[model samples]
Target: MGPGEVAAILFGGFALLIILRVPVAFALALAVTPVFFIEPRLTPLLLMREMFKSYNAFVLLAVPFFLLAANLMNGAGITDRLIRLSQALVGHLPGGLGHVNVVVSMLFAGISGSSTADAAGIGSLLIPQMKKEGYDTSFSVAITACSSVMGVVIPPSILMVVWGGLMSVSIGGLFLAGVIPGLLIAGSQMLTVYIYAKRRNYPVSVRSNLRELISAVTGASLALVTPLIIIGGIVGGFFTPTEASVVAVLYSLVLGVLLYRTVPIRRLPSILYDSARFAAISLFCIGTASAFGWCLAYFKIPAALVSQIEMLGLGLIGTGIMVALAFLIIGMFIDAIPAIIILGTVLMPVTEHVGMNPIHFAIIGVVSLSFGLITPPYGLCLLIAASIGKIRLVDTLKDVLVLLVPMLLVLLAIILLPSVILFLPRLFMPQFVG
Candidate 1:
């Protein structure tokens, strides 16, 4: 059979499984099976081999470690401390807890590297408080969902690690590339909160005294250093991103056990087990997605995509806009990890053909999909927030649409002005562009 016929069997089967509500990992594996049977030269064993190959990379090891580190920090009482610190910094701002939500997510984004973690950890902490203070549940859930996306855009991002591992790009360069856009997104969210707070007359906390602010920061100092250690270790040549994950785990452990005394030794086993369970699920999706991506490559889907794109005569800017839109749409359906594994490889050639920087394209892809974490149908962050708020998903989406306006604007800025994404990478990783 021709490759097109095979591609149809693979993707069509994948879609059928998704419609049937099979899990994504199983859906991907099941989708690729019929193609193997039909091709005669390929075997089911090849699927297993490809899945194994996907996780064989050393950098891919960072996914679980980062996840464990984030989970540990959540259990270690770091969330409340970060909340205290955020309140101290932004509590005086209009929509006190609203601003606190965005700021805490930004700070936690540095530590967690997972948006769902951000929404769950920070949202569970603040959403109730915001509601008690008269903030609407939908608005509380909306801000939590929107701001948690920074967890992926910020450095030490698991999605960026997955992207770097799959595409063989520089993880450190990707880390640097994410910093500015993450900050910009955080700033935009804060501005949105300001506008909402003023119009809604949301309550504001009394300005924190300097001494209390110092106390909050001092209490949260160890937790605050988690991101610095991860990013510093990677960027300073002290370790690879994988080793940096180790540093994050160790730092969170010591900070939790020795300093905070929140993580008792007795709880260690359960924490590790839960972390392993979540990590297994994520890695499983990644493995299957990699195999699915391999099938696409085998059928030359990327080349066909590039050729079709080239014929449109969309120059670099137009092609990038297309990349951003495509990922945004796909992200609404798929989790970012698997999406990165499957789509990053498929789209790399298309972007490169248009003279776009790989790092720029990487940021564009990450930022665009970050929104998907909140959009409906598969908005993981939104689902987490809505669940915490005990509100329906559709109601929370009302506010999500408002948040998306600012986020989309920032995304457009990154797309039109590549420098926004590249500035940090070029500044820090001179060798990347060189």
Candidate 2:
């Protein structure tokens, strides 16, 4: 077979491996093995060199530290405090319980940077209340799952960070770009919840007493600072995102261990151990994807694909539309992290050649990928919320469709108009160009 055919088979095999639930790292390495032997110019040493070189960047340093911070915040009861804070602020509106679920998801997105974490954290707190408040179990669970996508779209998103490193886009710009869209999604969800609440008459407590409101603010102020600290640390030039992750860990530790005093020092080891495991998965998949992309390049997949597309005359807008559609579809099936790793590596060159902004593309990519976390079937958040609400996936998936429409429109606007993302980054930090 030609090298391209060999590469095609390898890619097919890789997809099969993923479907079979074989780990992505194994799938990636296996996909690349053919190139190692077939192309003598690309030796086994080349693959290893690629892996080592790929991971050698200082930016990659932030990945593990950010994952660690997420783990610690989860373990230290930081997530719960933040949930309560979101609830206090938004829990009394019609469909207030649903709003609480989403608002909390967006807030937690900043801290956890993982949609799964968002689902797990906010689902545990909000789902029961939603059920008790007379929301349909399926609808409630679906809404919870849907809202968790905000984690990746909001700043400090792990997916964005990965894309930033891969595409050489501005991480800060990506963060800023996500700010308006994230709020838009949260607002959309809130609006949807309001409509649902009014239509169905879901239970809502009377707006909280002023004393409770005041008390809620007093108690939750510390937790609210988590995002502020993250944004300021990165935006103010005090640290890079990875550096900010370390700062986050230290900050969460200080608040949880010293000030709030929830995360016991003795329990730190377990937190580290848990975090290490998740981080290992992230790094391994990343290294493996790098290897797989190397293998693809060895066979000239991007160049071949780009040539074919360029011939087809699908200009930037057409390509963007098609790519956006594909991403939204795949986002429903795959988790954001590895999806970004695979697609970003392959499509980045094409995007750049078309004169697209890498930062804008990353924001679009992450947000587009986020749909997969909440959609039916393979969505990780769907399952998480289902488990919490004890709702069948089939029953909840329908309602999720209603919310998906508006979300897609918002994504389209961002894709067509690059300014939504680039504006804030330019306004605030002109110097931090990717």
Candidate 3:
């Protein structure tokens, strides 16, 4: 078989493994074996070496720290202050507290960096309150599911750190680029909530006076400062992303221990274990993907694919569209980590060839897959949101479909213009390159 044909078959086999529910790390290792055999540069020994090399980066050390920070915030009763603060700020709006949940989640997302955390913590507090206000249970769950996606886009996101690790991009720059867009999506989501509120003639609650506002802000301030501190330090050259994460861990500990005093000191051990456990899974998957990518590189698969694409003479915009669509489709089935790792091998090279910044492509790639966490039968965060809110998956799907247009438009803007991500990093830190 021809080289191109062989590459296609190997890629197909890897995808099939993911579809069959095989773990992503295993899928990468399994799919890579044949390509290694087919192409002489990829010895099994070299694949093992590649896997070892993956975690060799000091930047990758940021993943566990960010993850531990998230776990710390979640366990330390940070969500309660956020929820209370949100209620104080927006509980008086029509549809009152539902709008509050979205805004609060957007606010907290900067710190949590996880849709699962946003969904679980915010949904727990707001869903029941939503039902108490005479809102549809399904709609309540739906909004919670949708709003949680903000966690990925907001600053201090571990997922962005993961992207930085994979692509050698500036994680701080990525965080800055995301701020405006994240707020834009939050505005869109708030509008969606308003539409439902207006349609239902929902009653607005009035719980906040000036004093209450001051109190709520003060309460949420500690939890809120973590993101600003982490991002600011990274951008201001005060710390690397890894160091920023360590600072976040300390900051979160203060919130949980000295400031809030909700979680006992003894609880830190279990939280560390759980956070490390989750971090290990992601790291292993990334490592295996590194091994798989090494095999593909040895075979020169990506370079060969680029040659074939240029022969099509499709031009840059056409190729960008094609790549975006492909990532979206892949996103529907595979989780973001595996998708990024696999795409980093084949697709990232195309962007580089086109003179696109890896950072810009990373933003596009992340947003495209971020939508996947809300769609269909396999959206992990969506399922979690639904279960917590006590609504059926179909109900949440309907709400998510409403926002898909805006989501796609945002992705298109990132891909077509590229400046949506690039301009910020350039304006703030000219030296930073993805």
Top model by TM-score, which number?
1
List per-prediction Cα lDDT, in the order shown.
0.89, 0.78, 0.79
Give the per-residue Cα lDDT of candidate 1 at 135: 97
Per-model TM-score, in order, reads 0.98, 0.94, 0.93
Tens-digit per-residue lDDT, 57-172, candidate 3: 89878878887888888888788888888889888888887789888889879887877778877888788888887888878887787788888887877678888877778888
Clashing pairs in 2: 62-242, 331-372, 332-372
Which 10-residue window of candidate 3 scores lowest in summed lDDT? 35-44
Ordered by TM-score, highest first, the candidates read: 1, 2, 3
> What's model 1's overall lDDT?
0.89
Q: How many pairs in model 1 have backbone atoms within 3 A of each other, for residues 3 or more apart or on separate chains, i.e. clashes?
A: 0
For model 1, the stretches where C-alpha displacement exceeds 4 angstroms are: none
- Between which residue pairs do clashes occur in model 1? none
Error of 1 at 13 (Å): 1.6
